[model samples]
Target: MTPLLELRGLGVRYKGAVAPALEGVDLDLAAGERLAIIGESGSGKSTLARAVAELLPQTVIQQGTVAWPGLDQKARNGRDIGFVFQDPASSLDPVMPVGDQVAEVAHANLDMDWRAARRLAVELLDRVRLPEPALLAQAYPHQLSGGQKQRVAIAAAIVARPRLLIADEATSALDTIVQAEIMALISALVAEDGMALLFVSHDIALAANLADRVAVFRHGRLVEQAATAELVSQPRTDYSRALLAAHLGLHA
Candidate 1:
């Protein structure tokens, strides 16, 4: 079967930066597969996510193709992709009711009517395990906890039911327990919908636990990519080994 998403010779360069944010990056995300991009801060994992989501600014120069299964060309405006940003609070609108926001995504992409969209929003909230979907729907962004906000963000992203979901450092802001819940939620959603997941995070251990495949990034390049067990058990690159060592030390 054709991969749900494919990146070929992908590169991104921002204005005023001498070095490209990403270079010669390549990836294939099959349907229903969970892939994680793991690296340190400024390692370009988020850059790659933004590029795939088409969230990067127009000023940034990009080369190569980010192809989807049905589209003749790379998708723009997130038609075939959905993105959950690292910061949920920043990603959501403070003024709008959470329900309306989710409804808007569904309305825009799925062509759902207002009533149907609102109903779908409530269902989405429930799907993400939010309590009191009706009450939460009326609440503003400030009313929700960090984890709740992230759940809402994920719900909004899933409302469109896009083929690929790009979660960029999605659980980084939540506490460990909440992070685990969010990861489990995402994993469940992926399984239920058979959607491809691109999970970008700096936490190697977490990624190893969550992803089917893990790609290690260093200075804008993918240094290693393999099955999660293989990569964690026997990392081929020195950088990969160091990352695993640091992760082990942190949890020790």
Candidate 2:
């Protein structure tokens, strides 16, 4: 089977930056596979995620090929990829009704008519388990809880049933309980959609919970990657060990 997403010889350097944010990175994820990219701040995890989603700004210099099954770079420009950012509040439009925002995605990418897209929007809200989907649809972003907003974000992302979900620090802003709930919800949604997931986070334990495999990045370079259990139990590099150690201490 063809890979759901592939990156090769990928490198990124922001204008006037001292070093590349990412350098010569390669990753391939198949359909329904869950992969996590974990590293400390400034480790290029977010850059990698944005690059994969093709959401990077033009100011950054980029070198690489992003390959998706049966689609060239031009053809892969739409709904086949969905990106959920760290903060839904920032990503969402405060002025627009959240429902309309969600529906707009379907309208824009899926070519659904307004009425049909709006109808599907409420269904998506219900799918994400949001309360009173109809009422919530009419509400503004500020009216919803952080978790609810994220769910709306998720709902919007999957409204078109994209093949790959790029979650860039998606659950980082939520409270502990809400964070776990969002993670579980996203995991379930990904599985249900058979969408490959590339989850970017600093939380090793959370990644271990949701990912089949994990990739470790350090200073714009991919240092290690393996099955989650193997990487957690037998980290090869000192940095990987340190990351896992801190994660363990957090739970202990």
Candidate 3:
């Protein structure tokens, strides 16, 4: 089967930066597969996500192509690739009701009418396990908890049912328990919808638990890519080994 999404020799450099944020990064995400890009701060994981989503800042110079099979190449926006940003509150508009914001995506992408779009939004909120989807739909970004806000953001992303979902530290802000629930929700959604997931996080343990394959980045380069079990049990590079050791120590 053709890959749902592919990134080839991808590179991104911001103006005035001494080095590129990402360099020669290659990734292929098959339908229904979960791939994790894991590394510490400044490892270029988020940069890769932004590049794939075509959400990078204008100051950044990007190279290479992000191709999605069965999707129009011209429609490179949030509608094409769903992005659950790291900060859910900031990703949402403060003035707009959560339902309307979510409905907008459905409206824009699917040409859904207001009434139909709102119903779809509510359904999506329910799909993400948000309690009282109707009530939550009426709430503003400030009215929701961090986890709730994140759920709302995810609901909006999936409203259009995009083929690829790029989550940039989507669970990092939540408490451990909430993180687990959110991760489980993400896993369920991807499996149920057969959507390709690219999860970017600094937490290797979380990545290992959530991703089918883990790709490790160091200084803008992907140093290793392997099955989660293989990468955790038999890391190839010294850097990867050290990262694993650190993760183990943290858990210990």
Highest TM-score: give the candidate number. Answer: 2
Measured against the true structure, the TM-scores of the candidates, in listed sequence, are 0.95, 0.96, 0.94
In order of TM-score, best first, we have 2, 1, 3
Q: What local lDDT does model 2 show for residue 142?
A: 96
Sorted by lDDT (best first), the order is 2, 1, 3
lDDT of 3 by residue, 1-252 (tens): 887788899999999999999999888888778899989899999999888777789989888887777565644465667889889988999999998899988898888899999999999999999889998899899988999999999988887677778899999999999999999998888888878889999888888888999999999999999999998888888888888878765221
> Once model 1 is optimally superposed onto the true structure by TM-score, how far is the C-alpha of residue 66 displaced, in angstroms?
1.5
* Clash count of each predicted structure: 0, 0, 0
State each model's CA lDDT, in order: 0.89, 0.90, 0.87
Write one digit per residue (lDDT tens) for candidate 1, span 1-252. 888788999999999998998999988888888999999998899999988887789999999988887556666444467788889999899999999999999888887789999999999999999999988999999989999999999999988677788899999999999999999999999888877889999989889888999999988998999999998888888898888888866221
Name the runs in model 1 displaced over 4 angstroms.
70-79, 250-252
lDDT of 2 by residue, 159-250 (tens): 87887888999999999999999999999999888888999999999999999999999999999999999998888999998898898762
- Worst lDDT 10-window in candidate 2: 69-78
